[model samples]
Target: MANAISASPTSTDPGRIGVAVIDQDGKRPVQISAQFAVAADSSTRFQIVVSDLTDATEEVALFFCGPIRDGLDLEEVNQGPLVLSQAPNSPARYDSVLGDRSECSYTTSRLEPGHQTIVVGQSRYSFLARTGANVLYTVPGVRTVLTREDLGGETMAPLDPASTVSITMAGLPNDLQIAAAVPQLPDSGLPSWSYEVGGQPRVPGEYRVMGHLVTVENRAQATVFFAGAFVGISGAAVLWLIEILVTGALGGRPRGEPADRWEQTKERPPPRS
Candidate 1:
């Protein structure tokens, strides 16, 4: 494929991104779609479906440029040609072990002209995060690539510029209140991760970890005022007294006020009374 970028033996590749499909004909780019199922426990399931529109008579390579948390295994496939290329250090494996994650690529068996596969896997890996105290916390979201072979030593291709790829998150806790999400939203009102460069969509995923951004309302720490003083509650797992507001009397005395001064300073009734 003329549009395909070559991998460097020494330095990591930059174009490596989300799942990529190499079409020998390079006629049209493959179509890849993904959904991230995130659990409150921080565990995640990656459900991906990739299809090659070129539909070559021979087999082509399917490259996965993501974490190897559970290795890439097929959930379903078409009744055409296909093979698996995975072994110790084989070109087809999780992204990487220590350095240069871009070197990791998972190559799948052959696909006879325009084939699709349904893949479901998990990762103790990423895209989920939290900032701020428990009261106003955010559980934020949550890859790589290279070239080289199929059942043979394949050179995985970079994501095709014309390729259409979309990602969304799932399995969030029921109480989670979405405050904001990236790439904006539509009538669906659902939030998702957008992988793009320079405002253009479909950036590569191989070498870098990627995910969408989302801010959810943490009800427990959202905050509520009382008659006098507000309770400080930390949103973190191990709750702390209050990383924020302190106890200040609202109707009583006041914060930092000397008890004697407060007692002596009393309001007098109206002169007529």
Candidate 2:
């Protein structure tokens, strides 16, 4: 394994770089964790990693693409094609080589709702590249890790999160700035991958029909708690007038020790469908 595979950007891309590391290990199931550093121009760089396969000693074809739901093209999958920028001073680094998407196996669930089509993109240490005749190629990066190119690719079975990727963010431009700073990760306790492979449970837990319409002066109106994907609600609560959701001085540097802000903490109810 060479230690780190460098990332390259397109020539015509004149946008400034947003540096950040998206990291994860093979502790749990195949899950991804990411922390984004948004640049003023919103040019984002991501590091999707699966580490810990330094002990992987099996041979199997692997995948590196996303399981896109609605479907997407190569150009649409990545906008900068979202490459990892390797600055010499970056914290993250890799010792394995990237696997070509051309090698991975795929299975498509026909027109099925919540269907899947995996398109493994930029990957490392994953030996998905196949030979002309359909056979698992072999290579190693580290001692027992897959080779840079099997000429071919890895059977490092049961990949740990640190499967084969060690991408680093480098050459962070001197002028880069964070657009939005998240003081802490939210406790939402939800998986990063939004869509459930199989559609959500018919019901996550005990279910009951709740809420009802309020008829004031015979003008029926009701508020809702939540709505479903294709569900809709029409004659919900009628607001007296167009209302402001949040009010605060936006943009421009503030003056004095601290500026004041007016806020309404109450959230408008989700309309009943």
Candidate 3:
């Protein structure tokens, strides 16, 4: 069977890309390890599929935070609609939802929060685009090992500190960055996906959450497209006005000079409920 593709954004290429979140013990989401390659002049797109594996319905929103240097704040960037309804009829189930809400990118909504959504179940996310091209780099054999070392010494000895180690990915675009947040806590010493799908715990003791990027996928480039669309609409409107002016279709004296935008466009009074 074909692997189920989750919420992902449109790519510059023709094929579909996927984001897989492996949830063991039905807990916090873990993005799987992936590798990407780009030719010198070629460009690519990425989509992040975030699978919500709960039977009960809930409102879901995606937030981006940071390494302090990345400077991403959830409130400033989340201007567009973020809430998606979790129901049988919601339309996000389809793939390749595209468009930019702001500096962050997203395509379509794949809201399929249901009981059947299980291991290998996916939800797609997006990567911020640079200029001509970028690579979605993935690594092989490397797993995020998260370990909590217990101080097994007597009271007299100092307690051993548990270090949270995260394996980092290198060779990405300089402007790109990563932010991770956990949705749940670890249970037994094993990851749930390994036990349920692979029939054994992948790690005997420790594990780390792999760090990856969901690119902005080029806000400036996307703006060019939006500009083209706006110009097309404006051109059509201008043409219509000229026809009215030449054919005497306005049927009245010309209104005073077009109100300068500096003159507040007359505010419409609020509508009564």
Task: Quantify all predictions' global Cα lDDT against the true fold.
Answer: 0.41, 0.21, 0.26
Task: Give the top-scoring candidate (lDDT).
Answer: 1
**Candidate 1 CA-lDDT value:** 0.41
Candidate 3 per-residue lDDT over residues 76-144, each given as its tens digit = 122333332211211232221211112222122223534221111112222222222322322112122
- Point to the candidate with the largest TM-score: 1
Model 1: per-residue lDDT, tens digit, 1-273? Answer: 101211111212222223444435333565556666554434445666666655541333444433443343444344433334432243544443213334434445445344766666554444444432111112211122334333344444444455556666666555544544433444576655444322232232322222222232222223323312333332442242232223322346544568888777767677985
What overall lDDT, based on C-alpha atoms, would model 3 receive against the true structure? 0.26
Q: Order the candidates by TM-score, highest first — what do you get?
A: 1, 3, 2
Rank candidates, lDDT, best first.
1, 3, 2
After superposition, the stretches of candidate 1 with alpha carbons farther than 4 Å from their true spots are 1-17, 57-105, 112-114, 130-151, 154-160, 186-188, 193-273
